[model samples]
Structure formats: structure tokens, C-alpha cells
Target: MKKIALIFSLAVLLVLGLSTAALAATNGPHGGFTTNTASCAQCHKTHTAQSSHLILFALVSGSQNDIYRTCTYCHSSTGSSHYDEVDGEIKDGSNLWATSAGGFQSMPTVEGATSYTTMATVSSKHNADQANNTLVAIPGGSSALKFELRCDSCHDPHGTQNARQLVPTVTVWNTLGTAYNTVSTIPNGAISMTVNNPTTNETITYNDDHINDFCGACHTDYLQTAVNSGSTQSGTYTSGLYRHRVGMAAAGASGYNAAYFALPTSSPAGDVLCVTCHYAHGTTAAVSSTTYANGSTLLRMDERGVCQDCHRKTFSTSQPAVVAASSYQVSATDKNHVVLAFNSYMEKVSAQTAGNYTVTGTGVTGVSSAQLQPNGVLGKTVLLTLNGSLTTGSSYTITVNTTTVKDLNGLAVSSTGNTFTFSSK
Candidate 1:
């Protein structure tokens, strides 16, 4: 009788194992573990007739649309019972998320009709959907394949180490700031985002090394230690000005100086990346006040304000600082203007030299910084007082010779012909 009871128990164990397998197969792919369980079939089916991509659950993808439907299944307000499915309006909302993991719950969506693609006037945006034109040539890549920017250019469907499942690596966008090398957009990775449960406030953290490697993959120029000595700089570098540096090495947790960057490089848990400055999905164009999105690049903060975060006036080394504060606003906040804005905030200028700041206009005192709107970090216009000349409504050109001004390493900021023009009142 005891032997029979043992045999009955063994039979029950076998049945239980099969039931577990069945349950795994029944669960959807979004939450199921693929390696040891059922499979992606939980989300996609081979014969159920979904999109060209084979995404299932009646989610269809035609020639024109991208993967929005399948992805939003669990990411949208109507789609999932999970957190509020809405764009976080730049991380201000509760329970936000990005296509990248470690992101806030606020994510852009198609059904929600909220993506940079919908911006009528914005020029620089990642067109994640358009099927035909799915690739961009990443600047520093060795071969054509590595340079290809696909539909999911900045994302991964499977999952990754970085937030929102952003691509783990990218080719360096090594531009030399010359006519020969113009820069462009970047790529995403395979797939899958790591998200925290808002109900419990569970969180995940990332390291700066990974952040550096990921962002450095594309934005290679700033991180490059050396500049091109010859007319061209490709696989070669000599000595270049140190950029407001980013990357794992410069991450705050990595013993990098906080006077430069705050803790939590990019994420609240800590570690920084490109997203810390420029919004990955793009923001309203602060590129320029006049023709925004028209031509100016969209930036998270006005170009100069991005600098003010740490360097209230000066950084670690001594050099004529990149102007203490802004006297200018709503103008072009693009790279060329910002980089050359060495004196953008020189409120008062005295003609110490005869031909420099006073070549045509007189040097006066009391001009600092002023702009129309302060926009959080924005300051005022760079004021230059006229001293030697007296004229009303007459225009004059002032040229500042940057070669005379040097950096910490004693490098000239600009060679010649850096000018600003304003009419006399």
C-alpha cells in the first residue's frame, strides 16, 4: 500500500511540471523569460497574421508605419493597465518612461499623437517610423554597415544595459569642425527597456563607463583627446581643446570633479550620458529665437546655459572663462555661436588695446548680459559701451582677436575675424 502511494506522488509531480510549461507558453512575451520558458510567441505568433514584422495581438504594421503599435501595447493609457501612459513632458509627470530603460515613464507615442515627427516646424528629430529611409551614416564608422541608422536607430526591442534600452554602443561621430566633416544623427540598438514599478518605486541603476561607451560610440569628436594636426583629422589626432567632457571616466561616481558635473551623471541613480544635456527625443528648439526648428538644432538647454550648470564662471583651469553669464538671449544657441562666445557675457569692455574691441566702436563700461526671456538658465545680452565714438543710429563693427586670448594650455581660442555688430542708439 505504501509503494502505491509513492507511485501516485511521482505521477502528480510529472503533471505539475507540464502545467508550469503550459502557463509559461500562455503568458505574453513582454514579461516572459525566453531562454528557459515558452518564447516570444507570447507577444508574436507565426501564423496569426500580424504586421510585416510578425508582431501579434492584432497589432498591424503596414509599409508606412513603424513599430509603434506593438510597443505601445503595454506602454499606453488605453493599452496597458500599468502606469499613466503619457509623454512625461520632459520628465515632469509622475510614472514616466522612455523607449530607453531607466527613463521616466513619460514616453512619446503615435496613438497619443505626440512625437517629434509631428512637429511641423522642427528640423532635427529622430524619425523612428519612416520605413524606406531607415538609415543614417554615422560619421566615424569604418564600414557602411556600422554607419547605417535604421528605423529603431536609437532603440532596442530585446533589451540593453543603458536606459530605455538605448543601443549599448555606437560608432564615433568624429568631426574635425572643418568643411570636410559635417555631423548628423545617430542609431539605436536591438530592443527592450528596463522600467521601474511606480507603485513600488523600484529602480535600476547604470554605470558611467557604459554611458560613456554608448554615447562615445557616436559623439566621438568631443571625447577625442587629440585634434588633427594636418588639414584633415581622421584616424589621427594631435592635441585638441578639452571639451566639457562626458563619458564613464568623467562620470561623477568615477571620481570625476563635481565642480564640472553634478552627481547622477545622466540618471537619478547616477552616471551621465548625452541625454543629460540634449533631449534624446528632441525638445522645442532653443537653437535660435528667430527661426527655431527651422534650422537651429534643438537643445535641452540654451547652449550657454548648458555651460552654466557647473562653471558659474570658470572651470577647473584658468583661462579667460567662456563669459561669466549671458547678456544675450533668444539668439542662435548653436555650437558655432556658443563655442565662439568667449566674450558673449563680457558686460563691460575697456579698450586696453587700440584695434581689438574698439577697432570701429568705442570701448565703454557697464555692459554685462541681457536677453528678452531668462528661460531658467538664460542671462542678458552682452553689453558693450561705446567710448571713443559718438553717433546716433549709426552702425559699427567690432572685432575681437581671439589669438591674443589663450586657454589653460595657452592655446588661442580663435585665430581672427570673430566679430559682433550692433547699431549705436
Candidate 2:
């Protein structure tokens, strides 16, 4: 009887031990280390250690702006094992580069320069003392007061149940779903935390879809789905169709090429969340087949690789129907029929310089007129009207070359297979 009683007691203790471990693992992502008060303190100290931040006073390869060099110290500069670069090779991990697609600045923010308010790149001379990035206002601030663009702006070092440790209020998108944006419920509840000694598993459970809202907290203007018109071709902003599609639904829907594209596991219900497309810190240097810089975009692959993952088609336009005939002989129907089915992505049309289009044909006579769709946005296709008609059972060839037409990164349209034939009837 005594032996049986002792065995039962030991079994109960074992079960309790296992239960405690399971609970701890559920709360703490870093090897069961509770992400409570000290979550951020682990990285920073009250004394503000200079070693924590990398200061550049004429160092090695190239100069970095004050923003990138500072925060990347932990994850980038020191060759730390946690470095975010692809091959662990550093090429400056700042998010601001040439393409400020959804940036708040009227002009681009540059590095290697002291001030970002005016210049587009970073100035090496501008230290923390010279200019405060927070002095200038971001898109969405609760107080309407200006703040610096720092890591604290988006994250809470102390750690929270929120994904990526983002502040709570930030979970709500500032844009309020103005036009075509995702509308999802935000969670507001206290969660548990756990801590275990000597562990490296720091994963957070992101249950809700608030990444877009988090990005929108500062880039409010990015939520706008409106086209921009300007005088200079480069000056115009017209990617309204699907530029930085934040709140837009991504649940395998029509707006996106759902036929081929699949949503990431992170994106719930198929919303193209911010984190879905961009990395929190910058990415390692990488180039795409189209000769565009995909590293900066932080796309899953690189450059336009994000879009090309599902949309794999060549650039070609075809005439559905040749103009039959007309009294003036200049067939408006034929001209409209010669539409270019842009299998490839297009940059804004205004960027399309004049005298860049070259249309020629053998069977078709008098190629009267041609024009791009949407006037200047990154339209999916170009409408070309022809002045000639196709005869019964007659085959003809027409070629198109918008040599100046390019993707967002300025890679010109493929100059091959611009030809099309009318095969029957």
C-alpha cells in the first residue's frame, strides 16, 4: 500500500511539471523567456552604452546616414549572429534609399547627409545632435506634434502581445479605410508572458491583421488610392491602381492576380498587409533579373520579384478585330482594336516620353492613331486604333514597340515578339 501511494504521488508531480513547462512556452517566445518588462532592456541600458550604438567617424567601406548606422548596430554592423542581411554581409541597412514609394517626405529622404527634411539622401555629417528626425512630422500622429523617425516610433521595446512588439493604438490603421482598404477587427486584451533561462526562441503569435494599420500609423498618405498629376513626367505620381496596396484585400481576390498568386501565411484572409511586402529593418543587397534593385523593396525575392512570383507573362499587344471599313477609310474601330495586352507590369504612362511609340504593319494600311490607357497611370494595357481592316481569310502582321515603356525600376519593355498575326476569319 505504501509503495503504490508513493508511485501515485510521483506521477502527479510529473504531470504538474509538464503542465508548468507548457504554460511557460506558450507565453514566452524566446525560449520561454517572458517578454515582459525586460524584453527591451536586454538590448538597451539606462547608462546608454556607446557600444550599443555604432558611431561612424570615417570607418570602412561607405558612409551611412545617422538613422541606419545607429539601430542596425545590434542586427547589422558588428557582424552579430542576429544580423538581418542575407549573406551576413553589410551594405548599409537603412530603409530610406532612392525609392521612397510610400514615404512621408514631399521630397525623398537621403542618407550620407546631415538633414533629411530637405535633401533626398542621408548625409554622413548629420549626427543625432545636428537634426532630429522626429522634429519633422510623420503622416499620422495622435498629438499632431512632430516626432523623430526612430525605432521607438513603431515598436515598444518593453514588448507586448502585439506582433513585432508594436504599440497597441498603432494596431488601428489611421486612414480609416477611406476607399479600397481592408476592414478588420482590432483586438484589445491583456495576454500572458513567460520567461525561461538560457533560450533563443523569440517568436510572437500575431493573431490579428494589423500590420497595415501599423505602417499606416506613420505613412497615412500611402493609404490614399488616388492618382497624382504633375507637370514633369518624373514629377507625376500615378500608381494609384495598386501602388503599395496596404489595406486592399489580398485573400486570393480579383484585384490581385489571384489566378496564380497565393497569400502568405502571415496575411489573414488575403489582405496585402505591410509586413507581407516589406521587412521591418532593411534587407541585404540583391538585384533582380530585370536589373532593378529589389533589395530595397524587401520583396520576398527581389525588385519586381514580388509581382513576378505569380504573374509570368510576356509583354505583347494584339488586335482583337481589324477595322472592317469606313467612309473616311480611317477606321476608329480598328484603331481601338489594336490594343496592347500588357502581360508585363507598366510604369506610369506620363513617364512614357513622346515619340517613343513605333507601330508598323504589312497587311494593315494607314495605321491612323494610338494612345495609352488611363492617360498616365501604370495602366495594364495600351489602346491602339488602326486605320486599316482585315480581309476575309487574309493574314497580316503588325508590330509594336514602345521602346521607352518601362517597369517601375526603368527596365525597358522586351523588344522581342512585338509582332502579332490575324490567323483566320
Candidate 3:
């Protein structure tokens, strides 16, 4: 009888062990994770086949239309919806989820409509025929390029904890500047996860939270350090002046003083975050076709599109000249036109002897003859130009103990005066 009882207990133990192993195997690698879908099903019942694939509790039905059906599930024009909570504007009864319905209908669907393909309009900026053009293979025949935009291209239905359900570790803004107070969009450097296949005994790594890395996968230029890395900056990339701060922090982050956005030293967060300009889903702001409105070179709204959100003055299309001048060093303070030319003949007329000119201004009481070629302009301006009998490639020097010259504004020279040696180029 005792032996029979021991055998029964052993059988029970074996059955339980096998059951636990089977359960573990069923879970595979990404086990013990409850997805957001469970939470989404609270208000929605999956009675039909189509509803089973959707988050029924979504704010609206998914079978409505291409634009409305999918978006309205979580977003709404009124009530306590995600769209309303995010300060999204509602047009007519529906919010501008993807494109402006009214504006889209107003324009002719065919070629006779307006040429610009605004976000609010039905026109598409991309040339569909060109999308399938030949792919140029890289050196050594590694891979070919192709383009497509499916529903998954811009969204992750998994529901991210971050606003807009964004992928992890992305930077939306990089530096804080006169126009904005944020750093370049940089991804969080750390944070990782993994997936495993029980049957194959294989594991795959995933980084769900690194912001910049995720956005860089699509917006390639934002990932580039050198301009030539892609099409956005290519020939236009320049240090300190022309480049946009996409992935770097302002200059003062590490006590370095370069040309970068300024940030408060006390702010605990150090780098720019990516969600700054781009909505992980979409936006209703109208952009230009050639620049940001249609699409940027990197398929972004455009540099001006991003800039205009914070700087309205810089993106006015009607005033092209006004907008262009403000984007560069063409401001009133920039002295591009303040020039000075050395009149060698006038110097000779004023000089008592050749190779020397008289000094008549304040702090210019030198009794000796002036070095006409170089001494006529001694630190009088930030930059100087010499024009006269001084041939190109001629070397000269200016010596001044304490002399002051007037600028076009008639202001006395206030900067330190040092001997500058240079040959006309």
C-alpha cells in the first residue's frame, strides 16, 4: 500500500512539472508582458472578425474611412478624447486627423487643382511614379533602396508610454536658442530589451527607448554629423554658422563656449529630445511644397517648416526677401556692407614725404610720417579692405601705439590695436 501511494505521488509530480514546462515554452521570450490591447478592449467588444483586430474601446469605430476609421478609434473631435486633450483643432464634426477634409474637397481631385500639396489638402507631394524609380546600388553591391509608406510607417499601435506613442530613445529638439530653448533632438543612449524564440532558441535585441536612434532610422539627415552623410546638408553644411543643431547640445553644457543654443545650467536634463517638432503620429500645420509644406528634402516638413513653428517671421512665403534675409547673417547688426578702402593717392597728398601720411584724428598726434600702405587703418573696424596701388600679394604691416579712427557711424575705435601683417590676396 505504501509503495502504491509513492508511485501515485511521483506521477502527480511528473504531470505538474510537464505542465509548468509547457507553460514556460508557450510564453517564448517576450513573456509575462501584458500588452495595451487588453486595456483597449474594455469598452469595445470583439464580436466581428474586423473588430477583433481593432481596439474596440477605441474612441471611434475603425471601419469609418481610411483617415477617419483608424484615427478616430483613439482620437475624437469632442469630449474627453486624446485629440481634444492634445489641443488639436476640430473642423466641422471631425478633427483634422490626417488631412483637412474641407480643404481637400474644395480642391479638384485631379490635376486642375492647386499645385501645392499641403497637409490640409488632398494633393500628395510625392510623385508616386518616381517612388519606384531605379535604385542606385552602393559600392560593392551591398543593397538597393526602395520607398513605401504603410500604416506602420509612422505609428506603433503598441501604445508607448511617451506622448504620441513614440518609439523610445528619440530626441525631438537639440538646442535652446533665441528662437527656441531646446537642444538638438538626440536619442537616449541607454535602455534596451530582448525577444526570444523558444522553438529556435534564438534571441533578438531591441532598444525601445533610445529616441535619436529610432528617428534616425527614417530621418537619416538628423543622424548625420558630417553634412555629406546625406542629402539635407550635403553641399550646404558649415560649422557654427549654417548647420542646424539636430543631435547636439548647446555649447555651454561642458564649459565649452562655441556657437550653440544657450540653456540654463541648472536644468537636470542635458540633451535635446526628438518629439519637439514632429508629432509621432501627424500634425495639421500647413507647409509649403518646395520646402516644409510639401516635404523636406529628408521628407521632413523642411528646415523652414520646423523653424516657422517657433519663428513665424522666418517663413512668410509672400515676403520671400524678408524671410531670406533673416535666416542668415543679414541682420542690421551684421556689417556686410560696412567697408573701407585705402586711398593711396590721398595718402600721398597728405604725406609730407613718400611712404608716410599725416595723422590728424584724435589719439593720432604722432609727429613722424605714417606707414601709408598699412598704418592708415589701425583696428578701425572689425574687418578691413585695402584698395589702391597696393598690388595683390604685397606684404605690409601697421604699427600703432594708441590711435583711434572713426567708423561710418563716427564712433571712435574701441577695440585693442595690434600690428596686423598680411599680404593682399
* Every model's TM-score: 0.43, 0.36, 0.32
lDDT of 2 by residue, 289-362 (tens): 36642224443223554555334445234412122221111122222234444544355552233334433444
- State the lDDT at 246 in candidate 3: 41
lDDT of 1: 0.35
lDDT tens readout by residue for model 1, 13-75: 343233433422212232425567544554555876465467656653444334544554443
Distance from true location, Cα of 169 in model 2, Å: 4.1
Whichever of 1 and 3 has more TM-score, that candidate is 1
- Give one digit per residue, the lDDT tens place, for model 3 in 1-425: 32353355345335323333433432211123366423343223456424424534333433222323343332333322212212222221211222111121122111101121212332322111122122222111112222232222333344444323434433211122112111123355333333333212222233342454555554443444442333343322222332243444433223332221211111233333343344333433344665534343221132333333223332222210000000011122322111122211111122213222121222223233222211121111121212222333444444322223322222222234223344432
TM-score of 1: 0.43
Model 2 is weakest, by summed lDDT over 10 consecutive residues, at 121-130
Evaluated at residue 165, the lDDT of candidate 3 is 46
As for model 3, its CA RMSD to the true structure in angstroms is 26.8
Candidate 3 TM-score, true structure as reference = 0.32
Q: Ranking under lDDT, best-scoring first?
A: 2, 1, 3
